[model samples]
Target: MTVNIPQLRAFLAVVEAGGFSAAAADLGMSQSAVSHAVASLERELAAPLLVRSAPVRPTALGERVLPYARTALTAVRSLEEVAADAAGAMTGTVRLASTPTVSQGLVPQLLRHWREELPRITVRGFEGDSAEVAQWLENGTADAAILIDPPPGPGVQLALDGYRALLPRDHPLAGEAAVDIRDLADDAFLISPNGCEARVREIHRLAGVPFAPAHRVRDLATLISMVQAGIGVTVLSEVSRPLVPCDLVLLPVEPRTSRRLVLSGPRARRWHPAVRALAESAAGRLAAVS
Candidate 1:
């Protein structure tokens, strides 16, 4: 039996908006119509979706089916984009997911390159943690994503990222070619709670030291501010070197740890024309990046 797109969309809207009435508002349909559509979808799939609570919640089966439904819809949308591309009428947005590391500095530069190269196309970006980024790709929330050391997938290698030490500009160790982890044992260290934190801590553990941060921050800007003010030192990806304030210096770590950055999409393969174009645009701008 062929699945109805409207019913599938109704189910998704309800799940995302958290209630039948909200989904109805989002879809510009009556609440009863939205409910009926969702019921039809559940019947077609032979699975129950929403719990019918005040704030709608997905059942276990609904959770399992949602991703597939999203992928199906994305594939349909991409097919339409493909037709537009073939006709030289492509002017659509590609949704991209990335981390703060690249989103803060590199992504904007890439976007500018995209605008100059492909003026007709639009690129929409979303920032999240690595896991969340992957989730966006899997759930079809993003057309493509910049992933760091992700699992096996068909993707383009963008960069190999190395971890570097961030220190105050005038710190004694800043002039060194590479800073040994032990050198900052006594310093008040500022660390982020996510992204690079675990990796940095793992390096410290390997060196027989604990990564004890005197301060915990989440935003990359705040992290840099703390380091710039001589509050502490921390480790970050080399890609973030460009973002270091003039008051701060980025030095290589003695035992370098690096991650591979790639552009991955659904199933690690991109199908949408916009996603492919965006990837090519980014690949063309590597030299401009610090």
Candidate 2:
């Protein structure tokens, strides 16, 4: 029962691409070859990895093995990068994960800076909610991630984004310089459950108000529209200001609370050379600014 790198790569590609054909195209192999590699890997493991559905998904066993496969591939990629490192020119892909809020807020500028600093290194962005982004980093699905409210480590602090109230333009609190959470207690509360729920709950608790939300909305655009239509108000990070429609108003919370965003390599594995380079570049830039 010996598994090899190619098989692992094929398995991962199939899972990430959601089908054999797309995996084949991505790996520059024939569909049959991709299918064969996956089949052989499954046979070696003596278990089925994919459900073979319209959009293929991992089995329970495959889910357990997915992280190991990703970590192994990261090691292989690092080995292949040694030569590029020695040549004084680093060239490879850095799979970077970010939550939806950070993706909308900070990722664009980070990408631009990376493009200027490391033109040869391709930085691919993977967007998910906070939990999914954390899972991606833990499972090695991403070489690096920008984590929210992360614990202190080798990671560089990117930003401290404060929570704010998003209200309709004509709302009574909209005219105030800052709004107390208790002030909006009687209004319909539409919660953005992506990553802000815990902080919003804390806000309510601190304000001595109930945290019951009238609606739980996932999409930022839909949340904004709901607020605009006067259906409800919501709480979001200050970083979300750019996404708010001009017709809506964002007010600072009376008691400021912030989430820390950090950029770091995957916690479960050694950093890829390209990821290390990117982190170093970011740290240098931050130090210069400070």
Best by lDDT: 2
Model 1: pairs clashing at backbone N, Cα or C within 3 Å: none
Per-residue lDDT over 1-290 for candidate 1, one digit per residue giving the tens place of the 0 to 100 score: 55888888898879877899877876679999998988988888787888989889999999997888887777788687769788866467777889989787567777788899888887777789999898878777777888988878677777888889999978999899999888889889888887698779877887887778899998888988888877888999888977887878889886668888888767844457777666766666664564
| Candidate 2 local Cα displacement, residue 251, angstroms | 1.6
Which run of 10 residues does model 2 get worst, by summed lDDT? Answer: 81-90
lDDT of 2: 0.86
What global local distance difference test value does model 1 have? 0.81
Q: Local distance difference test, per candidate?
A: 0.81, 0.86
* Candidate number of the best TM-score: 2
In model 2, where do residues sit more than 4 Å from their true spots? Answer: 1-4, 20-48, 59-68, 287-290
